[model samples]
Target: METRKGLKPALVAAAVAAAFAAPVEARITKIEITSRGPAFGGVEFPGVGAYERLVGVASGEVNPASSNNSMIVDVNLAPKNARGNVEYKFDFYILKPVDLSKGNHRVMYEPPNRGGKTFGPFNRTTGGNDPSSTTNPLGQFLAPRGYTMVFSGWDKAAGTNTANFNATITLPIAKNADGTSITGPSYEYIVMGNATTTSYNLNYPAASLTDKSAAKLTRRARIDDAATVIPATGWDFVDANSIKLLPDGTTFAANDIYEFSYVAKDPTVNGLGLAAVRDWNSFLRFNVTDDSGTANPLAGDVQKIYTYVLSQPGRLLNDFRYYGFNQDESGRKVFDGMLQWIAAADGLNLNLRFSQPQRTQRNRQDQLYAEGIFPFAHQSTTDPLTGKTAGRYDKCLASNTCPLALEVYSANEYWVKAASLFHTNPAGTQDLADPPYARYYLMSSHQHGTGNGTARGSCQQLGNPLNANPTLRALFIALDQWATNGTAPPPSAIPRLADGTLAAAMPQSGMGFPNIPGVQYTGLKSTRFLLNYGPQFDSGIMTINPPATVAPFFDNPANGKIYPTFVPKTDSDGNDVAGIKVPDVMVPLATYTGWSLRAAANGGPDGCEGSGQMIPFAKTRADREAAADPRLSVAERYGTFGQYMYARGNSIVQLMNQRLLLDEDAYAEYTAGLAAVRAGSLLKDE
Candidate 1:
């Protein structure tokens, strides 16, 4: 890889030359570029001119004998290439400026969330999977800034490969030392949305498809209750990887918890996904070509690398750092900075035998998976409950390879994903300050995804449509400036125990939620428990399929014996009192809550998975009194559209001054909001 002009010549050349020209160990052997064409149909970005897209397969190998890969669960048992290195191949996609001179010396890497290429709120474009389409303004924001965008597959079970976004990896299955099959306890849970749904594809194939004796099927009324075993005769194995209820016309209860636990075989070397990401990013940044001499597209252009991952894949980023995958084979840093979006306190259910990377336990379904465990914080600290001390950056800190991190999550994370554990101690008694290298921000009064702020779906209340994208765009710029220049970002804007904003989640525990008309405020949250998955749990092997739970000592008085957790306190309008105040939350048209209960038909009273409620205030003061609504009327809060715009504009200006909102985003949102307000679409006063 060559150094671009304008950088410190001696330093850049010396560093890159030594890394690339030196005798290589285990690295990317080949990059087979399958397709090459103009991105966005030859659309020219502002200063970057036109960008080109490169889609390909990246083949790499890792030495199992090396200490760098020893943490991989079954690396020792994986099949090796002729060079005695464990081999892996994954699909990759890259969009870079056609001319290197016109590019910024940075790579914006987005690891696919379950095989889909999403920008994680940074881009307002729809169908972000297809970055090459001219119809969609995909990559319009970053491409103009001359950023080289990158993506690649890491999950082995990335089911179907869409033409627009196919990022799948191939990994070897772990076997016994004698080359025999290895099996482990695998569990799958299903909640039928309707009665007609009968079959489910298991995470892994059953060890013995014919042997129904060992496999057990059970049903429970709720996620927390004890499950009653459904007799084996009530179900049949449709195949090695699927199951169906017995008697062709049989149906399951709409919201009942159906659990299946069995001995599953052929576990992929799932942990290799971490290595794949590390090495690919390393290759793009430092190497000019692979061993096969396939040119590294952005080899000379990449001086800094940053990653943005959302939801499940965001959890993967957490696992990647925890297991020391941030340091490549040459002991160099992989990502210079990381923006982890929406993955709160949970780690991925990966890096273990029979790994289920997609399992995320919500308040209503998929309960008790191997996630939301200890070592939730980035800084190493002692867990008062488990008596263990560790952190996500422990390994990186020891190796001097820790990346600057920014953890951005929404209110849903606080309600459903145990986000409080990310900022607090394991016992939740006190808030722990973030490390100097990290910043944590909360998207106040927002849900997991953007919504239209309407009453629809199976939830008991109207959907929350608080858009956090404007704030996200600003923060991303802040992160880039902090990493590229010496400029520090804005202070973390999260609720804290030190402040009065962070409080108990339940209304009974003094959350101070307002009583809106026709709204049920049960204050249900996804409870965390101290789980024991047998003695081998720490070693990434779960001997017990459904682990036993142990109550923590620091118990919550409101929830009885359970792990302590907290949520951000609410204002009179039910919006979160803390965090970056967006325009919608500032001006206020309705009360937005992070938790929304499922309707009676689905599962009444349980918090809707990843959903938040938007209960509109009454139109007029008379309407509020007539409906017995405790919340004030929208007209009373803002007499006219002019007042509404004034308030929202003031809020946007404040955020801009703090560098928490960009000018372009602020202007766009203000105009759009003003239009809606003028049309009486945003605030109704009939």
Candidate 2:
């Protein structure tokens, strides 16, 4: 009962404040109503109470404990001008002992009904057709419940700005049942869009309407179609030799130069030109000059570089050569040399280079041999000094002076090296580790020239052959994490298959050798043959024509012997040759399922089982029936591949853009390259 005494004065003060704040503007202001109140006060405006109790208050009655009742307020704001065509209505509730200092407690209001028709534009339509009736009974029921409501125009010109609408509603609180004056908080509401000039006098007829305009709509392109079409405005392919001088006569000294080369194989279509390759070269550049116009090359300098090298001259563009690397040993030495020279001449470091070779060849006798086809073929031959095979090499083989080590360097390695240099220890320095890069990954069982091996068993069926090397997934994850997080990723975070679980571990070297009959040496051999040795001995021996192609043979399919036979074929030298046998390994591609299969599998009265085997197989009759159905759409067949591609491409672009923003030097170079491509002058005229 003591609580009632405290509420009366608070309600009176809130009412006084609302009366003063209402007339400051004649135009309506929008307000959002919510059921909850701000901290510090339990009071609500437009208080709530029983109908009889409120009636008693209107007649100046008294009830000491009545402060606990709720009150409802009807807000009405009439346009001041005689020509005013809009009226604002607001309804809200107030809790007992209202706090005037805090804003009014607000409640959401529903629109009113006119002749059984809802007042809003959205309620008038149904499924591309006009509904048979547009009546809203809910709105009509609230009208006689002591609630005030009105129709108003959301006109922009009537207000100071385009955002604020021309009209609003205001509610004033009066005395309550106990002869105690009730204070009401101020309230406002505004809607979006322009309203026509019209007045309603309760009995006025509804305005004539036109066909309602629809909201702007956008449809996603077909996924398969999108994947097949080349990008129109974003990055495309470029050429290795496409770099040319800017039309504005920007000349570069030998030291100011950057060269990027790569062998790009056009797997899509062949014979592309400079024009077709320029789109991808467009990029943003930043940070080459200081405030005083001095040339300063900090770690962040950025520029866009684009170059593509096809299999043949003037052919379709395929791969890219982006020349942005750290000044380290693992990167192109020639490029680093050029930058040093440029820095000495221009007082800034400007040298950078990147290259991609279609295939690298190496001399077998060299101490630091470039890993080529031959070493792999001869991997079974062991060196007496070291217990390891001659062809076996580790990550640091090139620097270790191993005679059998062959390093097939790539441009991606240089990018990784550059990224590591900028982000890792000895921060901001260009010095990079030897081989300044990481490992080269060969995927197992992947298709479309990706690699051969089973990457994961979870997606495998009965016939799929599992890949032995499981660390490939981890390497890629590491690369992405390194690019995203500055911290060097630990090998454990990379995904790998250990036992049955997906785990992370270091990548193991690929073993290429296969044991064959009569090949005295055994162990890992090259996946592909490198050479054809002549079969004959010395000339002084008895004159007998020698067989051609003296390569070692495994078991003869006919006799199961080591002897070579000309039955398969013979070369010009008359040496016997055996037919090459391609491996017939069955690799798992992807799995397909239907909605019907899912429904049937989960249709039991009991809950679904958690065991892997408990899940039904696709070969079930129900699954087959679902597959045979013709009504299934092409989208159903592809699963989410299209969506996945779109998301992946977007992610790649986002990452590149973010990197461009962070690295000034790289961004500048990228922008310059883009500009050259845009001007149709990236390639030399000759």
Candidate 3:
């Protein structure tokens, strides 16, 4: 590995210098062992002989010499693995890694929830949740090839941890040169607070928390337009965290943004979340002296680092790269490769004043601030709507800090996640092609994920039961080979401009989504509002008082900026036509969609905030006719239960041949799916 330009003088440890030059300034100062146990249930980690799980915190400070002495990052690393150590690369998460230069040349990861749900290698109170073996299934095979597992925390606001996967961060408060505390404007859009509900709270403490008289609130029914400021008599702050609406709770409607202006105290440069990861990875990979006041463990043996991010964390990756955090302070690079899952061209809402990184483009009812903005592609292109053009990787590429990237998405992204804008122009005339440095895929027929879903008691459709984790596992392997060995991953499966498969900005009725009985369909899509968080926002401090909201003409489809909301063409079953088609969709177990409507009773009809729906086909031809299912029943389509099984088996073979499904996992999933289908007795031969 060659050193990129800016960090020419980095101090590389003897071990690391033996291979390549790296940056200096930060290294893991202390490896606090909270718990150590044999990894993989005490079984050897395949190629790595006997590996042990070293659970603890890797504490230290950033190089005061390379950076400001004020920032000391204490990363809580849960589960650092080791054995006789045949070389290992730090396979890490949504945003942290311990040592980079120690072992193998490759690594993988999954940052599940709010950057805190990173549980791997630990037998949980729940059960065996090993992604490689079960959940994702990529690890089972990847383990044999040699990749180290790593997980740590970057978010200071992450919730309490569960079991062995506990993590949180400590951040320094930001202040001015005068030593005065920083205070600024912040806002919140409660997804669904009870309108009449008294004592409603804010996401962060407010200057008006105690003084109800100063609390000012404005309301917006939608995120794309101006909000009417409610008179002071319209609302009252009940306490530090509580608020009440006048006239009645109903005054607070679903999907409304309640803009409040308050001077927030003790601002933590939360954007430091990116900086912490940058310095930490540089420390690990280069073995440079760290603010930690310690030695680098895996210094020389490190080859390349890879990051695999999920959903929210995926957005974190988007911002991390967009902000140029990949180029560490010492001028070393952080990741050599990255896997972004379902981010939908959006970066984290974090990094700004009082950031709500945990929030998202709340379907149709809330603000879509950072989720849809500039740098929609790997190679920055002119914002057809804004006229500003910059690639997300421009800085990284310039510094040679850019990593090979693979992006995966769900069909839901096109439906409302703003995924369409990636391929189609704001005006919706054509599709955008991907750059050579990255590959993008839409895991069609799925939603954000199958978790966080209920029985659809709030909706008419049955909840989506499909998990695309299986597809992710296979792609992870492909990405690994591509990054480590230069074997290009499969050509991305996306709707193309030349192809007629690309559809855009279509009203609900135009997409041709069927109206299944009892199933709700709402025309509402997630709002991709263009927000100006005031001028100082980029400086990590918001200066605007009650930030103004407006929808530019380019954003309005009626005006047509040429940036359109696009989705892939679908087959008669309504599943997307592109990407790695899963067996469940290929074999037609049911109608699996990336889009579902919220039941009206549930304050919906807006896309079910973020879950797809699964409608089971009829069991028999008679039942199909009775239900008037537009698609034929599985039995009718395949003739018999045995026939359906055979067809599913064949589909698995096709997927394997196409490289979408590896031979090893394909058979296992096929057998399991067959057994389950048999047990459920979905279709029988007459």
RMSD of each: 3.2, 34.9, 7.4
| Alpha-carbon shift of residue 320 in model 1 (angstroms) | 1.0
Tell me the spans in candidate 1 whose CA falls farther than 4 Å from its real position: 1-12, 19-25, 136-139, 547-561, 679-686
Candidate 3 residues 52-82, lDDT tens each?
4555565534443233222222111111223
lDDT for residue 155 in candidate 1, whole number 0-100: 91
* Cα error, candidate 2, residue 343 (Å): 35
Where in model 3 is the C-alpha error above 4 Å? 1-31, 60-105, 109-112, 118-145, 161-164, 192-201, 209-214, 218-261, 288-295, 365-368, 425-427, 451-454, 505-509, 537-562
Better of 2 and 3 by lDDT: 3
Q: Which ten residues in a row have the lowest lDDT in candidate 1?
A: 547-556
Top lDDT model? 1
TM-score head-to-head 1 vs 2, winner = 1
The TM-scores of all predictions, comma-separated, are 0.94, 0.19, 0.81
Per-residue lDDT over 135-252 for candidate 1, one digit per residue giving the tens place of the 0 to 100 score: 7544456777777889998998785564766788999988898998898888888888887887888888888978877788888665546667778888988899888898866777
Per-residue lDDT for 1 in model 3? 26
Which lDDT value does model 2 have at 68?
A: 11
| lDDT by residue (tens digit), candidate 2, 121-198 | 222122111111224322222111122111221111112221221121221222234534322111001111122311
